[model samples]
Target: MYEMDGEEIFVIDGHVHLWDARQENIIHEGGEQFLQCFYDYHTGFTPEEEQWDIDTYRHYGADRMTEDLFGNATADMAIFQPTYLDDFYDEGFNTTEQNAELAEEYPERFVLNGSFDPRDGEEGLRYLEHLKEEYDIPGVKLYTAEWRDDSKGWRLDSDDAFEFLEKCADLGIENINAHKGPTIRPLNRDAFDVKDIDDAASSFPELNFIVNHVGLPRLDDFCWIAAQEPNVYGGLAVASAMTTNRPRKFGEIMGELLYWLGEDRVLFGSDYALWNPDWLVDQVMNAELTDEQRDEYGVELDVETMKKVMGENAAELYDIDIEAKKRQFRDDDITERFDLGTHYGGDAGAAAD
Candidate 1:
C-alpha cells in the first residue's frame, strides 16, 4: 500500500453500481428510471421515456462504470450494490445476477452490497439471510425512504423494515447505506425522506448508519444526526448536484462541511453510474480546500487522505479486511481479465481492477 513517498493509500470507492441489459427477467423502464435519476444530476441531461432501454444502461451505467473505475486509473477498492431495482416494477430496483458475477471476476476492487425491499416482508429477511450465507456481501443497503408510509412508499418504520434492520444488526453488519428521496421525478412532498429515521440509528447505536446523498435538502439534519449519534455517518456523493445545478456552491458548502465535521465523518463518493467518475472526483480534488482546512480536517493531499476518502473509513465502518480483499485480488487473475467499456479518458480514474 506504500508508494515511493512511503505514504500508504488504500482507496475503496464507497459508491458504485452495475447494470446490464442481457440478463434474464430484466426490466427496461426500470433501468431507464435509474438512468434518469443520474442524468437529472450528472449530465443535467435526461432521456425521454422512449429512448432509455437496456442499451442505455449498458452504455451509460454498466459499461461506463467499469471503464471509468477499472479501465483507467484505479482505486484500491470499491463498494457496490444495485440501484433503482426495488421501485419501478417486476424485478424492479435491483441489480441483476450478472453484477454478482462481475464481482466474482474482480473481487479485490469491488465489495458487493445486498438490497432488500421492505415490502418483501418476511421474504426479504429470508433473502437477506440467504445473501449473507451465499455471497460474500460486506454490507447491506436499505432505502428507508422507499418505505415512508405518508409518502405512499414502503415505510422504513414498518414492522417489516424494522425487523430487517434488526436482522442486519443481529448479523453484525456494520454499515447500511440508503437513499433519502426520489431521484428523478420532480421533488414531491410525498417523497420518502430519511430525516425522520434517526431513531433507527439511535435504536441501533452499534450499527454504522450511512445516510447516502447526505439527505439533500436535509443535509443539516444529517449533520445534526451525525453530531448527535456516533452511529450516523454522512456521504458526500454530490456528483450530480455538483455537475448540474451548484458546482461552485456545492464545493463551498462541502468545504465548510469538511471544516465543521473534520472530514472523517464526510466521505467522497461519486454516484458512478452517471457521469464520468473523473468529472466527480475532479470536482472535489480541485475544490478550494484550504491548507489549514485540509490539515484540520485530516485531509492530506497525499496517499493517506486519499485512502481514507476512497475506502479506508468504509472498510473500518463496514469491518471488511481490505488488505485481505486485496490479497484475494492479487491471487486471482480475474481483475486482469475483466473489462467494462470505454472510460472517461486516460489514467484519470484508475483503481485496482
Candidate 2:
C-alpha cells in the first residue's frame, strides 16, 4: 500500500510477467530480436540508475521479482499477464506455469492470468479450460500477433477467437486482456490492430476487454472505439513509461482517455520487467493532468480517480475485496517476509481496521 496525501492506496499492478529470454531459451532469431526490442524499450525510457543489466533483465529470478514489487511497499498486489512466444523460444516466454511458480508461493500478492492462441484451435480451448481448472484463473492475456507455424497472426473478432471468448464466459473467466501496442519486427501490423476489439467487446458484453498500452500509436482509433464500447478498458503499461520524460504526451493521452472512457475504465500497468513497479509506481501515482488538459477534457485527476486507476478498478474486474485482502495481507507470507505489519495497521485492530 502507498500513503499519499494521508490516504492508503492499495495498488494492483495490472500487468506484469516472469519470463526467460536467455540465449538457451532462444530457438529462433526472432526470440533474440524480441528480447533486444524489450531491452531497447527499457533503456529508451528508464532512468540510468534504475536500469538493469541485460543479463539481469533477461532472467531476473522470482526472488528479485517479489522484492522489486511488494518489498518496497510501492505496489500492494500485482497481476501476472503471461506472454507465450512458443514459435520464438524453446520454452515459451512467460507462460502461465512459469508465473504460477511465483504466484502460488505468494497467492496474496499476485493474480495469475493465463494465455491462449486462437490458432491452436481445439487444443487451445482445452488448454484454456485446463488453466481455469488447474489455477482457477480469473482472466487470460492474449498475444494476437504471435507468430504460428505459417501464420503471422490471428484476429480477435474472428469466429475461432470468439469460441475461446465464449468458453471464457462459460467458465467464468471475465477479463479479456489483448496486446494492442505498436507494430514490431516479425509480428505483422495486423497483430496490434485495435479495431478487432470493437467487435469482440460488443459480442461479449458479459466479459471485460482490456486493451494494453491503450493501443498507442493508434490512440485516436482506440479512444474512438472505446468511447462507444462500455466493456473496453485501457491498461497503462507502455503509456505509463512516458511519465519519465514524456509528461505532456502522458497528460494528453490521459486527457483523451478520461474524456472518452471516463475514470472507471482506465487501469494501471507497470508492464513490469519492462519497468519495475518500485519506481514506476511512484512516477505513475504522481501523474497529473495540466490545467489546459483538465479544461479540454472536462475531467479531474483527483485522488479518488487515481485510486480507481491505481487499484480499485482492477479490483472490481477481478472481484478482489480490498478490505478482506488487506486483512489477509496484514499477516500473510509477504508481510512476514518483509516485516510490513505496521503498514497494514497491525496490532491496532489490523483485521477490524
Candidate 3:
C-alpha cells in the first residue's frame, strides 16, 4: 500500500513477468537480440541505481521478484503476463507453467495469466483448455508478434485468432491483454500494429481488450480506437517507464488516455523486471499535470484520479474487493517488510507486521 495526502492507496501491478533469458535459454541469435533489446530498455530508461547487470537480469528468479514487487515495491497483487518464445528458448520464455509456480506459492499475491498462439490451431485450443483447467486462469496475454515455425506473426483479427477468442469467451476468460509493443525476431514492425485490435475489440464486445503499453509509438491510433470501443482499455506498462526518463511525455500520454478512455478504463502496470514498482508508484503518486498539459489535453490529474489509476481500476476489472484485500494484507509478508522499513523506505507504523 502507498500513502498519499491522508489516504492509503492499494497498488496492483497489472503487468509483470518472471522470464529466463540466461545463456542456456538462448537458442539462437534472435534470442540473444531479444534479451539485449530488453536489457537496453532496462539500462537506458531505468535509473542507473536501479539497473542490473546482464547475468542478474537473465535469471532473476522468484525470490528476487518477490522482494522487488511484494517486499520492496508497493504491489499488493501482480498479474503475471507470460511471454513464451519457444523458438528462442529451451523451456520457453516465461511460460504460464513457470508463472503458475509462483502464483501457487503465493496465491493471495499473484494472478497467473495464460497465453495462446492462434497459429497453433486445434492443438493450441487444447493447450489453452488445459491451462484454464490447471490454473483457473482469469485472463490471457496475447503476443501477436511471437514467431512460429514458418509464419512470422499472427493478428487478433485473423479467423483462427477469432476462434481462440470465441473459445476464451465461452470458457469465461474476459480479459484479453494484447502485446502491441516493440518488434521481436522473425516479425516486422507491422506485426505490432494496433489496427488489428480495433477489429478484435469491435467483434468481441463481451471481452475486454486491454492494450498493453497503450500501443506505444502508435498512441494516437490506439486512443482513437479505444475511444469508440467501450470494452477497450489501456494498460500502462512501458508507458509508465517514461515517468523516470521522460515525465513530460508520460504526462502527455496520460492526458491523451484520460481524454479518450477516461479514468476508469486506464490501468497501471510497472512491467516489473524492466522496472520496479516502488519508484514507479512513487513517481506516479508524486507526479502532477501542469496547467499547460491540462489545457492542451483537456483533462485533470487529481487525487481521486490517481487513486483509480493506481489500483481501483484494475481491482474492478479483476473483480477484486480492494477494501477486503487490504484487511488481509495486515498479516502478509508485505506488511512485515513495510513495518521493518526494509523495503524502499516505507513507513514502519503504516500497518502492523
Scored by lDDT, the top model is 2
- Cα lDDT of candidate 2 equals 0.90
Q: By summed lDDT, which 10 consecutive residues of candidate 3 come out lowest?
A: 340-349
Ranked candidates, highest TM-score first:
2, 3, 1
The 0-to-1 C-alpha lDDT of every candidate, in the order given, reads: 0.58, 0.90, 0.86
lDDT of 2 by residue, 265-315 (tens): 999999999999999988887888888888888988788989999999999
Error of 3 at 28 (Å): 1.6
- Candidate 2: C-alpha RMSD after superposition: 1.7
lDDT of 3 by residue, 1-353 (tens): 67777676778999999999999888978888988999998887788888898999998999888888876547778999999988888998899998987889888789899999998889999999999999999899999888777788888998999999999999988899999878686344486689999899999999999999999878989999999999999999988888887889889999999999999999999888888896788887777778899899888878899889989988887889887776666666656645534222234444346
Residues 1-353, candidate 1: write the lDDT tens digits: 22224443455567776654334434446455555555555445222321334346544544455656655444546677565444453454446354676676666567788877777778878888887877756677766544222354554556767788888878766577877644434345444466556777777777777777777766666666667777777676663346344554565556555544555666666666544454445444444445655555554444455456656777777676866765554424434444311121112223434
Candidate 3 error regions (>4 Å): 186-189, 333-353
Runs of candidate 2 with Cα error greater than 4 angstroms are: 183-189, 348-353
Q: Write down the TM-score of every candidate.
A: 0.75, 0.97, 0.94
lDDT of 2 at 174: 96
C-alpha RMSD by candidate, in order: 6.4, 1.7, 2.8
